[model samples]
Target chain A: MSVVSDRVTALVPSQWWQRSHELLSRVFEDDRRLLALCLTPALALYVLVAILPMVWAFNLSLYEVSTLNPVWEWTGPGRLLDIVASGTFQAAFGRSLVFGFGSVAFQIVVGVSLALLVNREFKGAVLARALALLPYMVPAVAIGMVGQFMLNAQYGIINLVLIRVGILNNPVAFLGLPETAMATVMVVGSWKFAVFVTLLTLARLQSIPENFYEGATMCGANAYQKFRDVTLPRIKNVILIAALLRTLWMFNKFDIIYIMTRGGPGETTTTIPLHAYEVAFNQYRLGEAAGIAALMFVFLALWSIVYFRVARPEEEVRVA
Target chain B: MTDIQVDTLRKEFSSDGGEIVAVDDVSFTVEDGEFVCIVGPSGCGKTTLLRCIAGLEHPTSGEITLGGEAVTDVPPQNRNLAFVFQDITLYPHMKVWENIAYPLKLDGVGADTRYERAQEVADTIQIGELLDKYPGELSGGQQQRVAIGRSIIRSPRAYLLDEPMSDLDAKLKKEMRVELQRIQQQVGGTMVYVTHDQEEAMTLSDRMIVMDDGEIQQFGSPQRVYHEPNNVFVSQFIGSPEINLLPATCRDGATVAVDDTDWRVDTGVDADSVPESVTLGFRPRHTTVERTADPDGIGGEVALVEAVGDENILYIDSEVGELRAVADIEQNPIEEGDSVAIGVERAYLFDAETGETVATSRRHGDRSEDQVEA
Candidate 1:
């Protein structure tokens, strides 16, 4: 006991250990007194809200948890297999992957291009940047509302323009058609979130040293070559991080698409979140919804690992 | 080798309120294969002048000629002049190999040739093993070498180095000084170097251009400029511990009355051209001090004795206020609070009113005629 106390005391700074070193640390041996005191309130809330729910849902996946039916039937893990094999869940999973990745890809490309273009000084640059930020700053629900009006089949401005231009004899059903519903929602989502990537890329771009460009100029590089050699390499790291964040946000995105196309003209854009919602609320199959949510959690965890490993966005960037 | 000349070059910049003339009608010429240094205090337009010579800056109303062709209107790319900036501006992204090869790649060179030339330049700079490392991984000095390597990969008309050694430690700076001199000798171009360090200017330059207030005070060989300063500013600026100035008047054709002493003036000033009032300038090495009360010399008291490794500098208080003198530590030892007598052996006289040189001590050994009537 004496040896342990002496070692513990040695670990602390001498000045601090010199004063008030005994009573405060007697708790280290059976430190549960203070540990339990410090850990009670926050731990209670987390367990009740987070841990308990997740554990219950995992256990609930093995039984029939129904709201309308009174009888509880033990189905074991077969419930999860049933949810996975359902055609609607499969379509929702595939559609979520397409909407999440496809929109985020276009967002990255457009975002980085705009960031590079606006990084330079010119007349009205500040005003133009502020104007470009309006689309991203607007609420996503409002943007979806506006997108529905414009993408309407009959009298929408898009169809009106196409009709006026005489390119199409008939107005295309952008939201009602299964083929174009997912793509329309993707275009709208990318339009709304592209500013996030632009801001991130631009911040990193501005941090790059001006002397690098001057050195390139001295080496006889033109404006375009300077961008290719110096600017692109410096900002690509932040673009990787921005793309990852956007993809994660879009993967579980439900509200914007739900308001715009509502699982789209026969489930063309029913993402994982929407499917989980329909199962829990409409069908009242609580156990199947839990299973679907659990699967999504697994897939997201695997995705995050693979994406971070592949991107490795921690490229060396000089501070000065 | 290239013959570069600036015909009354000037540069101006507009600030918030008005135009600021950075280089005020500066003109000089760099001979082929000559190493010239432009040295001045900060904000004295030495770097601006070098930038103009590199065609990075456009002159306000002047012309620059390279190889007997007017290149004032030529862009820097067309001028074919290379510049090494003060800061080591290596690309932080590329490896040392690609950074050195980037310039050749921009000129549309093939990948194989670019790789070969980059490796050769990397070997010249002695960074072969570190070629695969990014600049962020290199030390400040290594990055500086990469910058120089990038500049020297191509044979530009002339190399303009802008205080490229200012960012090194003292010992490292000395080492890199030798490295730079060796590289310059090997490359053998008309290199125009800019530095505010007069010691560096003196050591590295074949011909030095001393500037102040956007004007050239003196342009000559380092030996000639150090021994015979053309004006009081040049005299005080070119040396450490500073030159001492004494107020004097030309009493007659062959003598000058300085303070309470009348001394024979043997400076090369012709008797007919000698001005009435002058300031006598002498270097610390020229001022000899004796630790005794000698009637023939001005009496002084030693205020401080500073030992500077190889020599000692004595700060003596006399009728001229504080005067600095140097002594060889091996021959004569000095101490504080010693009564001393001061005498100047070599003196440079300048016209007090015009601030121009009226006479210089005869060290050139070329001007044999003594216009001093004695």
Candidate 2:
């Protein structure tokens, strides 16, 4: 232990040794005292907020605890494995995947189309861009409430307009049916996230040198050819980054989904995060909740790895 | 091969400020298989004129007839002309092969023929190994070669190049200029090039149109433009270290008083035509430097000496007011503050007000008999 400690101490730098020697002789040195003063708050915050909670959560995930009797018994990694293998937990995990992928796909399509629409030099384009960003700027809870109001079955504006336009014979319960419920959540999530993607794509489009398109036109390439050959390839990296971020955000989304559907009309909208919340607060199953949280943490870590691998910029890839 | 005849081409851009006349009533003709360079200062509408010929920009009024067919409203692609830009506007996302093959593909050429022709062009521009690389992966010079390759593969009626070599370094520019001339000769197409560099125009063109302020100042062969300029602007713009102009009053017949010195200069104009004030233009090479005691010359102290390795340039503050003279390196050296005499020969005189060349005369002309006392 002493040898290992000495090796670790060597990496702390020579200044630490000098300061330690000085402190041993006197209790303070000017440089060492100043360094301590600067690092104290940051170290305290790290220990209290980051390290303590992580350690506590890790410890809690290894126990069995129930709500009825406020007691816990140590069970090693048994509970973590049990939760991973359970059908309900697996279903919730699949639902989370659906939510993430469904939202990201819709967002990329709508976002790229919207960006292209506003990319041209036309009248009222600025207004269109500002209106498109309204969904992103609204608070998540507000967005959920707005979606609920608009998608309401009886008195909703959407249904009213559809009935008046003769597109529907009866008002549809958009958030009630299981299939339609998941689809509605995905659509709402995408609507909210599309603004960020559009902004990212617009920035990428602006950075592409104008000469590229002009050269394409001069080379006998029409509008579609220019977009396919020049604009798309130039902004592919930015699009990937935007998609990755949207996927991560959609995977962890809770407030919007909770407010809109409350994981109701069955477990159709009960994603992994919603399941974790129900276990921790409603059922008071502390150990199971911690296990769910740990599973979510692992899933996100794997996803991030995949994202980095697939979304790496072209410059990082070797060209043949 | 096809001839390009631009008859009174004019273009006016409507900016928020007002109407900016970019190309104003420009008229010229380029014969089949001939290379013509439109040389001008910046903002003189040289690029606009090239774009007009390429059908990239519409003329406000005028007709561009190619092969006796009016092409005023024709689109660029339909006009069958290719343009090479100064910025080397290669599609950064496309590989060199795709870039060079784009025009052929647009014309519905088969895949095999397109690739084969692209390879042939790639070999011509010496970018065969870089065919698969994207434009962003290549250097500026390589990208420019790819751009040229793209144009040449189309076998367009005429090629419009707007300052294509302006972005290259000095050494590369020189090498590419030689290669470009060779390519033009090999293709034998009517080529219209625009550049601000007179040396490039002189080196590469069969004829050049020198323009300034949206008007053609002179249109002639490079040799004619150099030895006999139509106006003061061409005289100043065509040569390195510009020709020097001195104020002179056309006194009694063919005799002009240059400042306090009297010179017997034949106007070469009709005997009846004499202007009150005329400007005397002489190239630095036309002025000879001599010792201070030499007779039959204007003398002054040397202001500056510029050593250009192969030749030397002496700035003399002589009686004609700061004359620039080019002398051989092997000649006797003249340092700053050294008094020297300059003898002018084969000088041109321009009407001072109009800046138009009035006459040119050799040193020993009929006017020499009216020699005046200094």
DockQ of 2: 0.24
Model 1 lDDT per residue over B1-374, tens place:
68899889999998888998889998888988889999889988998899888877888989999989899998776777778889888777678888888788889999788878888988887887888888888887888888888888887788889999898888878878888888888888888999999999999998899998888888887777777777888898898888988888876764566765644444444556768888878888876677785435554788998999978899888765888989878788878888876666677888999788788665435552222110
Scoring model 1 with DockQ, what do you get? 0.36
* Share of the reference A-B contacts seen in candidate 2: 0.36
TM-score of chain A of each: 0.79, 0.81
Model 2 superposed RMSD (Cα):
8.7
Regions of candidate 1 where Cα sits further than 4 Å from its true position? A1-63, A69-74, A123-136, A149-180, A318-320, B58-61, B68-74, B108-112, B132-137, B246-268, B271-278, B294-299, B351-354, B363-374
Runs off by more than 4 Å, candidate 2: A1-58, A66-70, A123-134, A314-320, B105-115, B132-139, B259-271, B293-299, B319-321, B331-333, B362-374
**Residue A213 in model 1: lDDT:** 82
lDDT of 2 by residue, A1-320 (tens): 99999999888998988988877666345677777877999999999997888778878899878777767888898788899999989999999999989999999999999888888877798898788778788888888888899999988998899999999999998999887999998898678788899999998887777766766777777788778877887778878888888888888899988998888769999998899899889988888888888778778879888878776753421121
**All candidates: TM-score:** 0.84, 0.85
Tens digits of per-residue lDDT for model 1 on A181-236? 99999998788789888888878887877767877888998889988888877887
In angstroms, give how far residue A58 of model 1 lies from its true place. 4.3
